[model samples]
Target chain A: MRHHKALFKFAIKAGEIMLRNGAETYRVEDTIERILRTQDLEIVESFVTPTGIFATMDEEDGETVTVVKRVRKRTIHLHKVALINHLSRQFVEGSLTLEEASQTLQEIESRKPYPPAIMIMSIGLAASFFTVVFGGSLRDFCSSLLIGIFLALLQQGFYNSRVSRFLVDLLGGSLIAVFALLFVNTGLGAQLDKIIIGSIMPLVPGVAITNAVRDTIEGDLVSGISRGVEAFFIAVSIAAGVGIVLKIWFAVNGGYIV
Target chain B: MILPMALQIISAFFATIFFSVMFNISRKELLYCGLSGGLGWSIYLISNQLGGSIVVSTFLGALAVSFLSRYLAILRKQPVTIFLISGTIPLVPGAGMYQTMYALITQDIEQAATYGSQTLQMAGVIAIAMIIISSLPKSAPEQRKAH
Candidate 1:
């Protein structure tokens, strides 16, 4: 049992590396992710139990490590923290060891979060709410909400990413817009923002975008920049939805010029 | 007037419970988490009602939760973020996201675009509120504790 927990025991060690490597968000950024990605390890009931990172994961050594996380405080060499960046700056060159640079990455990788079902549902609802709010009108709101949540759910249903996620989003937005309109013909009132807004609320990038901007303002440059990029992409996605729909509407109805 | 606000508090309460459960909160501590969130949300609503900025309201709400969690972390002997994230849900700018999105649905392109930027601002404000409220432990740049 002791041997099983030994491999992942470097968690605190990993944190030390964050400061040593001068990485942003301290590799603690991806805790849930790294634990889930281990091919050799099997975790049993690792919830945020009051016990501190509780779970029974079988280590490669055929032993169970009873993992319990606690308030980990340790002093680190602040000078070493600036050294990696200094070295890179002095070199002014691209050639660097993947090991050195990647050590920081591995630490970040370790902080990835677990995508729980309820959280996913919450995310979907939030996204739906955002779209519904923009769509306006009860019919538009409901359709957008339904579509956005459905699309987000599709991402879950297929474990989608990259290109697949993009395709699903486009399809999801289009489908929701079209269907919500169709449903409106069923005699729904004009004041349906409530339903629509609630549904699409999950789609808004508020949290991620807010976190990004806040990080930048808070002085976590790397995390702030990365989060900013993520926020930009989400914004772009929303823009694309607007552009595509507007183009279609223009072609058919001669609506206001974009 | 008060009912939806109470409903929102309830919604936030459930959200906190879900987060705590995921984190493996002790069963005995469950009510504390929910109540902390609900109470934090009520404070947020009240502050916003008093002509305080949403960001300011969120900050106050987060502060309420953070102080409580810090107390509970001592009383309950657990990490503060665990309690903080749960209790701070109601103040997370969930509603602003919809406001921006609703603005975008308009045929008025100019207005839609304006709302888009507004949406981003709200998001940034919310993040600031969250970050400001959660008192992070200081460490050297090299330290990489789990966030």
Candidate 2:
């Protein structure tokens, strides 16, 4: 009974790491099942969602151990997912034991994300490059780079304030539009469209949209629909923020096509 | 023209690498992620220049990215999502969505509907392209041996 409990706990731990790292539902469930099966456990079943994991292991002597883990926050850290996948494979191959695998998982869970300053710089670079890819002029690229840096700092401020994700995105989009408009009016850039589009790339929900489609195809209907709605609202919020700023600009300019 | 096209591809590469860094992809896998993004963007640009509609270009671009990410995953022993998500960044319809919203804000109903539907169709086609690639069976020895 003690051994069964330990193995089950380990399986759930693996699932927890993957789920919290923004893995799809099917991948998490498969990892849990594979981990438990390698231990020679019979009748192992796992159900995973975007927010939780449920699994049960049944032994021949009528011993059953069920584990449930709720994952509250999900961030993109594919490295952790890949690391856990490698550890699970090693454990299944008989090289590592449960204790070592769990220890490694703990270490990964506690690992800090990249420093804020580096992340902000990366966002600025991405925005600048995206502007160039979208056919912005050199002037527009410089403007986007500067505005992107300011947007990152503003986002960090919102993050520290513990505001909801929706509000942050809304404000971020408005801020981008406002800055881009300011630059264009000051003769720093010629194209408002390109500048705004470039800065908005960092806020777009590319992952959510992809995962929503993939989840729906995988028949995880609940997760699929929820993610779809989340993506939809994010798009709406971005559009709304940009629309509000554009409207304000239009009114101020007396509807002139400047 | 050729120089501009090359610059665009290179910029796409750096943009994807930056996003990969933002997502915490390991440094070892960063180059592959950038390649995936650059290749996808170049394909989209070429197709668009060749008179392909936005929907067609986006679909082709996403299909290439998905297939490349799978192959890279086999070689690098990393999860497919590591490359897949970052690679798809360049092909997403950020500009189209913005144009649609701008049209609506300016009270141009016809333009709004046009851009809005174009964005929806492009999104749908990209999803279809991804589904098609993911459904294909992998016969590569490396992938077969990994399982």
Candidate 3:
């Protein structure tokens, strides 16, 4: 009985980590089932969504344990997900004990994010390179690099300010458009369109779109539609942000054509 | 012409590395992620050069990236999402989305609808590519089935 209890706890812990780290709904359920089957539990069922996980384990002794975990925050940290995935596989293979598996899960949970300097530098480089791939010239690349760096710093500031996510996205979009327009109007870069597209690449909802499709295909209609809505709004907000800024630019310059 | 193509692949490489860093992928696997992205982008560029439609190019590009991610996942023993997410980043329709929005702002309703539909179709094709690649059973199913 005690072993089953510990195993149940460990299974939920693993699922929690996977879910918080942005594993898809189906993957989370599969991982939990695998971990629970490590023991002789007769019944192990798990259901996971983007925001919650509910699982139950029943043994032949007529004992049942259930756990409900509400996941409030979701981020893209594949390192944590990978580590937990490795740990769960090890446990299921019977090489690791219950206590050890739980301990490892704790360690994975507290893993640190990449250094801020590294993140800022990478974002800047990504934006700049995306510009080049999209047909921007050398001058345009340099200009977008500056814009990317600025946007990265701006995003870092917004991370801790407790601002709403929608507002941040809207402002970020407008900022990209305004900066690109300013640079082009000042003759700093020859292409405003390329600059804006490159700078906004990081803000696009690539993961959300992918996850939505995967979830829907896996028969999780709720998570699929919710993630799809989330991606749609992100696209809309970015567009609205850029459109508002462009409208203002046109009005201010008395409709000076592009 | 060749120089620009090389530069495009290099840029895609760097872009993938940067994105992988943001996701905090472990240090050892960083280079592979970048390679996957570069390979996918090269496929995209080459197919575009061969006169494929945007939908076809994106579909092929994402297919390559997804297959590569699966291979890398087995080799590295990590989750496929690590490589798949960053590798497929280059194929997302950010440019089309922006063009649609810009058209709307300029009061070009017809142009806005055209670009909007194009963007939607690109997204649909990319999703299909991801779905087809991810559904393939890995080789370890025998072991999984034993349990």
Which structure is stronger by TM-score: 1 or 2? 2
Q: Rank the candidates by DockQ, best first.
A: 2, 3, 1
lDDT of 2 by residue, A25-81 (tens): 777887899888876766899888788998998976888777778887677787888
**C-alpha lDDT (0 to 100) for residue A239 of candidate 3:** 80
Where does candidate 3 stray beyond 4 Å?
A59-63, A256-258, B140-147
lDDT values of the candidates?
Answer: 0.47, 0.85, 0.85
* Candidate 2 residue lDDT tens string, B15-116: 999988878888899999999999999999899889998899999999999899888988898878888889999988898899899898889899999999
lDDT of 3 by residue, A1-258 (tens): 877877888888888888888777887888899988877777789988888999999966897778899998677888888888788888888898888889889989999899888888888888888999898998889888888888888889988777876788889888888889988988888888888898888888877887887788788888899888999999888888888998899888877445
Minimum summed lDDT over a 10-residue window in model 1 chain A is located at A73-82
**Candidate 3 backbone collisions, by pair:** none
TM-score list, all predictions: 0.53, 0.95, 0.95
TM-score of candidate 3 restricted to chain B? 0.92
Q: Model 2's lDDT to the true fold? A: 0.85
The digit string of per-residue lDDT tens for model 1 on A87-117 reads: 3222223343324534653544344233556
For candidate 1, give the docking quality class from DockQ.
Answer: incorrect
- Span of ten consecutive residues with least summed lDDT in model 3 chain B: B138-147
DockQ of each: 0.09, 0.77, 0.71
